[model samples]
Target: MFFTPLSLLSGLSPEWQLVVWSLVVTVLISVPFFVRHFSMQAPHEVTPFPFLDLPRELRDIVYENLIQNPSYPPCTPSPKALSRFGWLLPQRPAPSTSNWVMLSNHQVYEEYMDLLCKQAKFTLTVDQKNAKERDIWPIRSETLKQIRKCDLRLVTTSKMLGAEDPRTMPKDWPLRDKICERLRGVQKAEDLNLHVRAIGDPLWNPLWVWYHASQAFKDSAKPCFQRITFSLDTWSPGENLLARNKEGQWEWRCRENHFVATDAGQYLIREFCSALYAECQDCPRR
Candidate 1:
């Protein structure tokens, strides 16, 4: 009689009501288990985000660090300095204390990054390596933890170094010497915590020739990326600014070959700011 009245009130059969009540209880009791199971699963790997066409602040940090800083010091160019032959960076890249001259590697803390800028923008900071070790290898525990969040990679790919061209190599191959790796990007390079940058060949993308001149990164923790950025679905076509030579190393080319070529447009700074805001809402700087 009790079952009959409950069924009449609910307008549901006794068997169906039991099933519904069981389902509700199961969901309430097992939610924690479901969350735990999902959390135990390994997180997926992420592809790098392309920043070839980002704002000036993003692109010019290399310059500000090695060039604009008065104490940063410039790399001393050798008497046969490749720079004099148009094979090097400009004085604007280094601090005034630099010698502006060199054959050997300029001992900057940000080697691969400076190399990339010198190759692309044709500049470096100081030829002198007299700065504190903290300036060069700033990889303190805090900085390392930050850089780790970004996919780490190395440069020294000859093509990006602008040192080797395959046409100049011996056909037998393997005879040409090229060096890669060891330069850290975010850690020791500078102090910005969220500054997502890399100093080597094609940071995340595995398919491209002029891979080192530019890089891509995504704050996977951000709402826009969280799950989508690392997936194959989010990988987009990138613009490479270098040509691969016969030596199999990627080299940096001029910006003309890129997808979004920069054009000469004159505008007031306010207009420029307004337009930029209209477009890139996620940009961190003004």
Candidate 2:
């Protein structure tokens, strides 16, 4: 067997040994970095997507085509109707298409929402019977800020508004007040149409209710709307009564019923515009 001489390694000075070890350590540390630097390939070139670069009108058209109808959950039927029917009726189903690509990103979603607010007749139903802050949760604050038009539907029951009782007012008046406050805070809404539906005696007038509600919005310091329309929906009997006259001739009678803004409601709207003019006059010039 060949024996290596220990003298060869042992005879080296401590300085020489340190120098050799330092060189070895340096090579060991630098090799991996050099290998990585040379071995890494350049990132793959990204393909240019021109969809975002299109004109705003063309982009809007593209987004409109991509938007699918929102899948809204079925509203629960009234308890009285359910009890009368003895079973719950199935609600209309939403479309089955799974493509909601427009809602995939924030930018496209905003575009779609803006289109809906501007072009479509978006309806927000507020059930005054079950007055809840969450009722308005379907609308986002950002959307509210950008709203150019709004159609607000307020549904009230006899019990909700105390329509049956002439002497007592609604117990949930504060909730209605809160809802008006929220509407007042919408800083960009321009055209507002309010529809009130009451489920009680057809003779139960809603003029006072409409006036007060409109007044609440008009009195806001920073109202966002220029035009407001108020309309009320009341039950109208569809049948006509036929009676025999004294001369033995048949007579037909029908009651004329229509849904339109009452005199007081129109007056309140005029007052609202006047108030807005007054406020504008008081403002300091920009």
Candidate 3:
């Protein structure tokens, strides 16, 4: 016969039932205490949010969409600096919502930075006159170590510099040399493209001018870039500034043929073309 609690209690004497009920009450009262004590000794468990549970690829896509392009203020004279040096200063990129997510926690920040520095291409502008105020290398050293490709835009014109000082001439080799020296510390970069903006004189041979300018970064030692391309910007107004050519090379179209196509340029174009074709083959049109 199966004995249910009701059947067992019914079989007990009235006094025995009262004793059993008291014992059951005592056990029930102590059970919560025992559970609390054991739970206190165990490690706390954290339930991850739904977003954190997403796949890595999906999370990266989310981060990419959240990342905003930095806004650059037009180079203008600060009142104090204008009074002191009588020249405009090169402005740093205005604070933006670019890396806000990276400020959350150490692990998340590191992962975000890794994706940004490794896979993304960064454009950095350097003005010779405002070199002291504006930094060329904006990313932290640790982050920069992960960068593989960089575009260094050099703005060395008199108008940008805000003075016609002969010493601060655009063609001065010392400015380029200094910039190259600074770049040598970026030892992990594989490719460096130099985009130069300068007022060209009619007497100056644009090819030789750009060649000498690029020669500063041809170092084989530290921060040695595997490939380098130099392009001259004629600063044409209201035109398509940057475009990819048939060969998959990003060309800065100038009104004049400012860039003298060298072996380096050809190599850069070929490499880009190969990468494009490889990507196309890997992921063909639907």
Candidate 4:
């Protein structure tokens, strides 16, 4: 028979009843704390994952699923960088979740970083302001060495726009020279993209002048690019900035051949076309 506390205490003396009630109250209060303390002390069990046991091929697939972004080769000056310029500037995207996942362990970190460096296409931006501070290659040489493809954006200052001939650019124009110097260190690349905005100036007008003035295309000895793509800004329809020749090499050509009927224009076009073929021939592809 279960006797309630009130019923049991009813038969006891006043002093005895008071002592029993006090004991009951103490037990009730202590029970929760006792349970909580033991719960805290008990070790949590973690389920083991056999990720490391997987084959290298399978692990690469997993790494690619995690880290390879669709909008890859994302623009730099990340959100953190923009914060320094005041809140008015548009916020850039944060690093992908894969970046944080790499921090899980040293093994994962090394493997993921290696894959990222080798496979991912990187955008290398060089501006006059940042070049002066010697901050062109934001990443280390070790990481840069693994890069296979690059989208190079060279932002020229307004003052540079005034130069009629890029070849005759003053000695003070060290920014372009500095960029070229840095590029010389890159051992190889599958594709090198030079943006129209970067090379677009009064000097590059008529397109033929690029072969004579641009150092990157002029120096065939460098032999770094397997394929060099120049993105052009054009309003004309059916105007292709590049076309594959009979020999399978990409060549720059103006669609409106009759438009450039002048003897000088035709000669310049021929020179540029010939130079393009030579540059492609010299660049070794692996």
Candidate 5:
């Protein structure tokens, strides 16, 4: 009683009707196979690896290997590419190319955030050109709290203060103010290594500057540290006062005739050491 395509073929000869039936049967047989073949073409979602299932020690090792000296973000394009109709686009933090594993998931971030701030040595290069902007380059207060060690490299010029006389230097100079402001940002660090390098001839003694900076840090932040070391980039043999020894340690050269000759230099040496050592008794230079 079922009326189907076979009924239409009934008016034809027996052979033709048989042929129609064969065609219909063949299509029916192939429909399910075709459906299954096409459905397999779709992309499939993959489950993330079970990294957290590993032991804590293994996780620490992975974190240590991946977290050292991360690559910096890319520089901005030329002014032409960044400008629109004579107007410059607002600047944003360059996309970081390092430690991207932290963004994998919330659990990974929670486990690695502390290690990133504590173990990795953050370097900040400060000079007059960029010191006016935010001093702590892309660091948050939460991260700043956990920072244990930092290298602060200050690029200074000789014209700011006369090498022959420290008395002529102003107490409230612009460079000193910027330097102090930068120091206050890292007051919580445990170990601080300060490197002072000059851009011109006749490198001046920076003890006076450090003395004031230390005093400012004490007054404002009540700084606490384990060890503080100072290094100078001197050009002249006479100016090589505090050269690091072969053992990669600072050798005290302040007692030389060049430094001891000037009462002002002697006073600065004593004051700088006293101020820094008062906070960090275990200074490496000591």
Candidate 6:
């Protein structure tokens, strides 16, 4: 093999190989020590910004945690209802007090069924205009397009009873393909877990599911555990949701940013956690 020791280190003698290995191990072992020393050498100036509080490396983690990955899986959409209306669930769901919580972004994306369902939604859209942005719902990119292309009209809720409907699963798997592509796109990274939470029943009270999903995770946290959050923007009121200008564009209005349903988030988090633990114990964890 090209990587055989004799081939790879052709010039090295047995003694030199031992020395090189020792050096490699020594280098690995010293990294944390050197890092710690340098970190200690820096002044402990408290920046007003929380992002600033972290080291440059840590700061990046915070951004990826907060800004870079700024989306959550909407609740588990009703896949069972997919066939008749196609996958479109909500044109818009009104905000609710029950939809809020803190969840480890990691745990939620670990094949959490609810988040998986949102992923299913991304695949079924055919509107190419704002398709990517709209379908990525809850998760967003600054450049992401808006959700404008689908032709959803409210057929009465009873249509859900139809059995011939197609699943929200896109007949084509481009959405899933893109997710995989993005993952593979990150070069040389050894560990990566996308923490998309499923807001189950996206068509039906999404906020309620989101709040409960987060609550499930929170309720499971041990006292020793540190809590984390999904983006807080979901619960914030739009600036001008109530007003419309003569020019015909949605106006922006509110100054408050972020959800404040702490009690609700906590409650749903524990309850869902209990249910998930029980379900996963019996079957493979979704």
Any runs in candidate 1 off by more than 4 Å, and if so which?
1-74, 81-95, 98-154, 157-239, 242-254, 257-286
| 1-286: candidate 5 lDDT, tens digit per residue | 6776656677789998888889989999999999999889777899977898999778878887788542122244556655475344566545555578789888788667778777877665655555556553555656656667766555555554323455555455565555555456565576655555544444455555444443332233323322223444554322323333344343333423121211122246565454333322232443
Question: Per-residue lDDT tens digits of candidate 2, residues 159-272?
Answer: 445445533443346656666666665676656555555444455445445444444444334433333344446443232222223442323322222211112222443453
Tell me, by TM-score, which candidate is best: 4
Candidate number that wins on TM-score, 4 or 5: 4
Show where candidate 5 strays beyond 4 Å.
1-47, 70-98, 158-167, 174-188, 201-286
Model 2 TM-score relative to the real fold: 0.48
Question: What TM-score does structure 1 among the candidates reach?
Answer: 0.18
lDDT of each: 0.32, 0.51, 0.54, 0.55, 0.53, 0.32
lDDT of 6 by residue, 1-286 (tens): 2577657666778898889889889999999999999999999888564533456555334333332112233234355645667555553333322222124344333323232222221222112222255243334332222211111111111122121222221223343344333323223222222222222233543333233323332332121112222222245321111112243221221222222222223233345333322221222333
The segments of candidate 3 whose C-alpha lies over 4 angstroms from its true place after superposition are 1-50, 68-94, 133-135, 158-174, 200-211, 219-221, 225-286
Worst 10 residues of 3 by lDDT: 275-284
Q: Clashes in candidate 6: how many?
A: 23
**Global Cα lDDT for candidate 6:** 0.32
- What tens-digit string does per-residue lDDT give for candidate 1 at 187-275? 33321211112223433332221122122112111211111011112343322232333442333323233222222133243432232
Model 4 segments more than 4 A misplaced: 1-44, 69-93, 160-168, 171-173, 198-217, 226-250, 253-286
Number of backbone collisions per candidate: 31, 0, 0, 0, 0, 23
**Candidate 1 overall lDDT versus native:** 0.32
Off by over 4 Å in 6: 1-172, 200-276, 279-286
Better of 3 and 5 by TM-score: 5
lDDT (C-alpha) at residue 140 in model 2: 62
* Candidate 4 residue 154 C-alpha distance from true site, Å: 2.2
| TM-score on alpha carbons, each prediction | 0.18, 0.48, 0.47, 0.55, 0.50, 0.19
Candidate number achieving the greatest lDDT relative to the actual structure:
4
Model 4 pairs in collision: none
